[model samples]
Target chain A: MNDKITTPQTIVLIITTLIGVWITTLPATLAEKSGPDSWLMVIIGGGISVLGAAIVTSTGRQFPEKTFIEYSVETLGVFGHLFNLGLIIYLVILTGMVVRIFGEVIKVFLLDRTPIEVIILTMLALCVYLTRHGIEPIARTAEVLLPILMLPVIIIYLMIILFNGDLSNFMPFLRLDFKEIIAGTKATVVSFLGFEVLLLFIPLMQNPHQSTYSSFVAILMVSILYLFVVVTVIAVLGIVETSLLIWPGISVLRMTETAGTVFPRMDVVILSLWSIAGFTTISPMLFASAFGISRILKAREFKSFIVPLVPVAYMIAMFPKDVLEARKAVEAVSNMGLFYIFVVPLLILTAHWIRRRVLNR
Target chain B: MKGKVFILTVLIGASIFFHGCWNMMDLEKKTFIMMMGIDALPEGQQDKIKVTLTMPVPRQLVGAEGGGGPRPETPQQILQSTGNTVYGTIRQITNRLSRQLYFEHMTAIVIGEEAAKGGLDRFLDVFQRNKDFLRMAKLYICEGKAEDVLKMETEMEPLVVTYINQIVHFNSSRSLRAINYSIGKVITELHETNGNSLVMRIRPEKKEAVVAGSAVIKNWKLVGWLSDRETRGILWMLKEINRISVETSIELQTPQKGLVVLDLVNFTNKTKAKIQDGMPVFYINMRGEARIVEKEERIIKKEENLERYEKPIEQAITKEINNALQKVQDEYRVDVVNFGEHLRKYHPDYWETVKEKWDLMFPHVKVVLNVDVKIRRQGIFK
Candidate 1:
């Protein structure tokens, strides 16, 4: 928390955070709803999330060095305290949902028989360790690991295309009706939920005014990456097959073979890399929650909130009994996140505007 | 610093105690199932599927030139068990085999005609559900028991799985003798299409296995078979023909008017569906480039003769494709050539109305085939 993050670090953090478990599951969900037009839905969804990120970053920019909790209180007076509490609750729940999903995906792909608690705990422990150092260390960590995480993913997608991808899977483009297209876009928008973490981290940026630009650039990069992944999965596995898979991204990588390499399977390498990406996502969420709590209580030290919040996050993550339940819980959290992204930011901005007018008058 | 070290030590200790290492097995102790075979259970047996696993011996894969007493006999072991489900059957076999059975390297799965006839939907459930099994494994339908194909002793390669993989992958590029259908493709065809598709048919000879033709599966049940020539025509329509030679004879007013061979260099097919006279009409355009490989009747090595060669080649392809289309559309009554897929994609509104009766309408749909062949080059001297 002592050091300040630059706009590039913010952009890197936004990109990595935006692509968590969604990288594995979004294509299938989109395929289920939009058919081959899932690629179109990705574009629409990314555009919607870019607007969401703009709203979030702009709200943060209004409050100089203050995060969401402090800014909301200054804008709305006593009611802003309730708003801050709601955001804190939202971040904690979002963190818990992410932990559950990250653990569930790793369990399904890599460790079949591992206890779900251990998986969640291992990830939570890393998040706790990272968040204790605050936003600066997290941003720096993201800056260093972004390429390491993204290179393999890009290579995996490129390999699928070069090997034997059939573009016909993406054919019959724009075939979905208006209703289905909107529904598909909604599913894709859920994957872009993690980008809203910008609202909390923007305060830590060295140049807060540049946060909005960095957020848009980060979201655009993530959107293009997601577009490639969704199109690649559809092209390689076809629409119906992609829909049938629980994790089409991992399944698509499993379909490809790198002949000379001794690594028997590429999916293992991808899973390992994806688990690291999941670390970036979960750590930011934990930081947001702990940061929100520290800001509201006016505590000078935020590290104390990290440990006590672990048990709470661990409890919330273990709330879901199975993967299906975990997904439903994550969907609920994502819907709440959507509200915070669109409604909360706009609400705070409007409040600030009204207060400024009254004070000027 | 003291508290940080204490916490770090405790975290490492807890990780060692609670990590996911229980399911770990050494590479030496585990056995990889290179290929699997599913067959119908014996009469009076309660089980539904008899699973056959082909496992390669690591000791035999090592070069046998030096430090080898006699080249290791039986480079692979074929194990079988009967159970109601594929996973259940594998678990049953695991009890009989000393080593743990793993399927990460499984490259192919051969389904017996009997088992395929029983309905492939049920047999494919485990392949789709299991995370360990790869969806990229090539699928083959055997005329007899799949176990026979998996258990065959190969003359060239030591392992039957490698031998089968070579036949499927190599022949797919060289000729249209075998159709390459993976589990992913089959699943997509079954789920997305009208559940009518073709799987490469494999038959075992005494010392070798012949992979050719295709087994037609409709509604996930074995419907019939397509010959090698028929498969070539189907491949041509599907635009999957990699390299194939077509030989056809022409009647000319000459003493030695005879056959001409053309090696297909490139291929492309376009199928469009439209309403003609209030019925679905499929217009298929098949364009190909070929080189004159062999010719019996030698006209002067002129350009007109090469142009004249194209007409006879197109006619020959059209005739073969017509026969194949007739058998698949009229005789077998299956839309395995992706005609329904075209209708569903292009004419969605019409597809909605007739999709239910597609099985009835498929045989009656007027499919017009237009073949265009260009002789790109005529060898060194024509």
Candidate 2:
């Protein structure tokens, strides 16, 4: 019953989590703000995210054997319990938003007549099953599924670039307005929010010292993939058309025509693969929240908490009235995630530093 | 054992919910529309549009096995409906059909001249928004009503849409006159240029359809048309021309006149823009290699220089390009030559200042042309 995961598994988990439903809309979101300079915004956003991940990982490495809840309780005394609850709340809401968006996309593209509630509930059931096994099984599932899901997507992107890409669509390059690019950078950074899961998983890493390196490598890999996706989508569809579509990534796949091949269209194939990607993304967050609840209740096993939280997550997923409102809710949660990713880690590091200095005195 | 039974019950219950068969319609019950045509309603009609959907009958398309009898003349069903919006008309047609109308397999979309002139953004919005619509569908502007082009019978292929698609695919690659403008490409171009772009034109005849030239779209409305020769000239400037043959008559030193057909084997151009006195001036350098494909008379002597033949060919190309440039710039007042795009890519600062009034300034911009044509081969005959 050893629960430790290898560094490679952690890296895979990070990559799959960072690339949820957002990758499908990142190009359009970035393009809407920065026009043709969206690629530059992605690079800037990735650089900032790498910095944020470094701080969170360094904080987690300080208490290598304890989870984030344990370390927070030890650091802030009474407030630590409240902070742990906040973190769990954030993770629960995030999982709900992710599942809701996934259902929305599946309904629009694949199953036009399926009710959104059915889609949400089924996805939650699968995630609950995965989360009940704890982090080790979730990491194992991600390790086995990342390559199967990503390789085809990367190949299709490269094919589109080779056959249909127009380099001139990236014109008016490097001519970004300062204000617009700053706004675009903020939006792009929100997409990189999932990498903060390292704060919870770092304790489970067999080699805690390499946690920094693993997180860095994972964020870099995701950044490169994001860069490729954004560039290819913009190059083929152009900035104006890309910014107009709700799901520009899927639209790009739909427009791609692979002549003389067995499968002329690839949107269906890519979407089926993306459903797996969505599973990997939400399961980790679900596990984090359930594990946090068990730790707070002083229970030995997190499995019992998983089922009860499913209804909570389902309720939150159904809270949004429509797609537009769901998007707004996701953005609100992402902004809160920014606080936990940046401010909470900085608070812990400063408090730990001050405590050590006083002990030395 | 009790725990195991409970887990098995939950798993079996989950399986029922996960199948997601609610949206599934049997393949036999779905009718696939191969082509869609949009036209303006006839004058004094209540609805704004007339939509035609062409669905292929699979049984007739496959033909009878071992039965040596005449097949149905038209193996496709054409249904028409009228409504105010594109989606409404489609739904109106769906009301009468026995099976669900599917548009995923659509090959082409033809818009009549009246519809295109009224502005295409309204008609194109549904195609852009709906996921079932094919973005790769080829878009063409019919010379008259789109229904005429959709209903025209073709002896070459059983389906008229496939025939039109093949004609577009063949002519776009082999000739410079026809451009292969897919829905995706046209939408991107229209968005990039703010609704100023070009669309391939299709003209319906008595029994067949002709796909050639292009319709000039300005501000989302069809403003004018470009002839085949003019389209070729614009293609040359836009660097979209491929495998085009040029025919020119040249005078020889032997006091004989001959008609020379030269195949422009390799052609490339470089366009440079510079701002002078608040106006942009373009410098175009055109270089190509030509091989004589046909000759009416023997005009080349053993000792004659090949450069003599290259001069007339270059002049003819320059004149053709100028004619197209003049028509687009002066008559149409459209900048289909991509000078605005070129300036935006190379000189962003200069473009930002003039992009607002580019249409006004495009007609006055001076163009300097440099042509270098090399006659590489004089054919097998001396």
Candidate 3:
């Protein structure tokens, strides 16, 4: 407990802790149910996920010295270990799927000639190496690259504002019925799902008590940014164009005309920076998988596990034949795999709450 | 060290794949569209839509500021094509070009005055649909040859798009008139329930096609055009007085009448939907600051002129605005000002009961115009 184990800087940890999980399939899954209103789902989904985050934050505070893996075993015993393994397995698959999604995006949008396996393999290879470095380096990388990722986002917003942002795009507000909104919210709440990953890092943080607050702030900021992007894309591109286009963000990248400048195509700078953030996002998932497996195997250190798993992931990513199938597979992961994020966080809180009540009696 | 080497290798591999591909739109081979004009071909030519695209010839030198000089003598080279549809015309024109045209660089789109008056819905349909066109690009309805306005030279900007962009700049900065009439706003209005719209009117002023005013649209077609003065008046009603000066002359103490200009620096207009005597009534509340730019008579105290000038300018501005509003409502019968939308947003439920009958109720609906036009500052040493 007293050891100086390397952990993330508070801000980057908070951010990477959220984006590490959410960003990949959200743009695609939100598109599934609502078509254009998919962004609305991201916003609604973010809000619902906040509730899960609050519970995890409170529950993690109970065993400040323990990770969710340790605390779950303590709370639920041998059966709990089995349940924790199941959750870890779901998260590992999520890690695999994220590698597949980002690789597919790179293959389709950025590099058409490049094979999807080559792309996913390369990204997974990086992820395995970074995981071996431990969580602190991942957070440091996020800290360094987040600002660069933000510049293009700010530029896109200003471009929309200067050119004319159609407020009417959001008008006819609440166009979807309450039932659909609720359903959409359920599906999307997972888009904001990564906040619950805080439980896994409880032991790593120097101060677990207040980490939840940072998690909440990260969720709020991400939601706002998600809404900003969703609204901006829908406003400019309209519903039809937005639906068919593979990457809505890059389209906004291409839309901007640098008035009175030599440089015309600015999406290049944006794609390059976003790929770095993608690295931060993917590495954490792979790290989480390796770490979880280390505890399960009773290995000496989680770092030892990353090397062998890299090729396994690379081979798994190859299963998705192409970009379209890979994207569809990621969406399915978010849709079904979201239950893994939600159920575990909810169980810890409810179980903890009931335990507190019985103890009081 | 193995981890570092493997990680570097992966990053390099990924970079080689993504390498400079997403943002690549080569400028050298791309045609920079200067001006675009949309028109329905002449009578009996129902199958054809006329398009005039003005492109920069590179050698043509034009500038923006040279004291309103005569129209440049050079014959403006414009490519004209006719096709059954807007996309058809675009495709037809593309065949004539050596390079691909980039709609991203285009600044102004002009629909001829006749095409605007006839029906702009069919004409602007493609611009709204096309992926190539820019959202913020200015759209116009021309007074004459759709190509003539584009042919007009400027003293500063080397291209027509750059020139038209400058003329329309004054509108957006002040936040007047449908947030300065971008293509996206026009498209949005066409689709909105209340259906409010504006298209910048283009006419040859000096050597260039300066933005004349604005044309209002109802449901998707252009209903009426506004002169710059009338347009400013309409903008004031819509509460879009960004930083425009409203100048009118009147005698000061029986001295020779001088131009009294009120430079509206800022404004916020709120229109409300209310049931007054079982009738749907709209109340427009306007808050703005006016600055006196210039005057000819031996001026009284700048503060003293505030009282003397307030009532008349307000009345005059109000009268002009009412005329514009009436023309839009009573004659043209369009709610291009978005007074209806303001109500729909603020009072959505209340609007629902009246939504079905808003058309009949609108023209007769009592509009309570309450203006708080404040004179904040006067011109120095006038």
Of the two candidates 2 and 3, the one with more favorable lDDT, higher being better, is 2
Q: Candidate 3, residues B178-232: lDDT per residue as tens digits? A: 2356675566556664355777877766576656577777666667777666676
- lDDT per residue, candidate 1, B167-270, as tens digits? 87767766666788888678778887757889989998777998999999998899899998888778877844422332322222223477766677567778
* DockQ value of candidate 3: 0.14
By descending lDDT, how would the candidates be arranged? 2, 1, 3
- For model 1, the DockQ equals 0.47
Compute the lDDT of residue A197 as modeled in candidate 3.
57
Question: Which is the leading candidate under DockQ?
Answer: 2
- TM-score for candidate 3, residues paired by index: 0.73
Badly placed stretches (over 4 Å) of model 1 are A257-264, A359-361, B1-24, B61-72, B241-256, B296-304
lDDT of 3 at A164: 37
What is the iRMS for every candidate structure? 2.1, 1.4, 5.3
Deviation from native of the Cα of residue A221 in model 3, angstroms:
5.4
**Least lDDT summed over 10 consecutive residues: which range in candidate 1 chain A?**
A255-264
Q: Summarize candidate 1's per-residue lDDT along A175-272 as a digit string, tens digits.
A: 77889977898898899988766767777889999988998898899999999999888887887888888888888776654321334477888899
User: Candidate 1, TM-score vs. the true structure?
Assistant: 0.92
Error of 1 at B229 (Å): 0.7
True-structure RMSD, every candidate: 4.0, 3.8, 7.1
